[model samples]
Target: MAIPGAVGASIVDYTTGFPVATTGAAPNNDHEAAAAGTADVVQAATSRSLYVSAVPHDLLEDLIITTAGGYHLLRPVQTDFDSRLVLYVWLDRAQGNLAVARLRMQKLADELIAT
Candidate 1:
């Protein structure tokens, strides 16, 4: 399924803000992606007005993001990651949400198998 206005998408490790894997977006080297994701998380982690808070380091796992032009939706996906990592998604602010986007990502993640 195609999400409208979905320009860029990637799975970033919260520990470092890097891409575990990416699609529908420009290619990012693992180190660069990790750094970017980490930076985004750090940027958000310090904000008091964010709709949601970062997972505690002890609880950090996977994360997700969905955004458009006006909103950026983010969520942690490692409820089961044993506090090690997370998936961070970045969406265009105009087309993202805090609740629904992650559910969709969760659905997709559920279908993927670890090799």
Candidate 2:
């Protein structure tokens, strides 16, 4: 939530590559596509981690994708309900602070577990 120039945010199911909840704006206003695409990104990162570490349970805490125009922060949310959930935030790089966004995303993940 502290992410500056945030265009949108969503809670997605990585297993199904589908969005469970979404807020704010999405590129082209296409939340579904964004969710699915981002989920693929998460899946790829996880696969790479597994290949290198040889541990399927070795999960990535967060992944940052920096584009020419903005930053995409993907944070995995592990809760009692499900571990396949992820939080995605799209931020304008010119205005966004990566460190602050990461901290906020961690905090949000904690709060999500409490609920």
Error of 1 at 60 (Å): 7.8
lDDT of 2 at 3: 64
Alpha-carbon lDDT, every model = 0.47, 0.84
Model 2 TM-score relative to the real fold = 0.87
Residues 35-82 of candidate 2 have per-residue lDDT tens digits of 999889888877667643666566578989999988899998988664
Q: How many residue pairs clash in each candidate?
A: 27, 0
Tens digit per residue, CA lDDT, model 1, 26-79: 324354554475547655654453433444444323334333343333345443
Model 1: residue 94 alpha-carbon error in angstroms: 5.6
Residues forming the 10-long window of minimal summed lDDT in candidate 1: 59-68
Off by over 4 Å in 1: 1-4, 26-70, 79-83, 92-100, 112-115
Off by over 4 Å in 2: 48-58
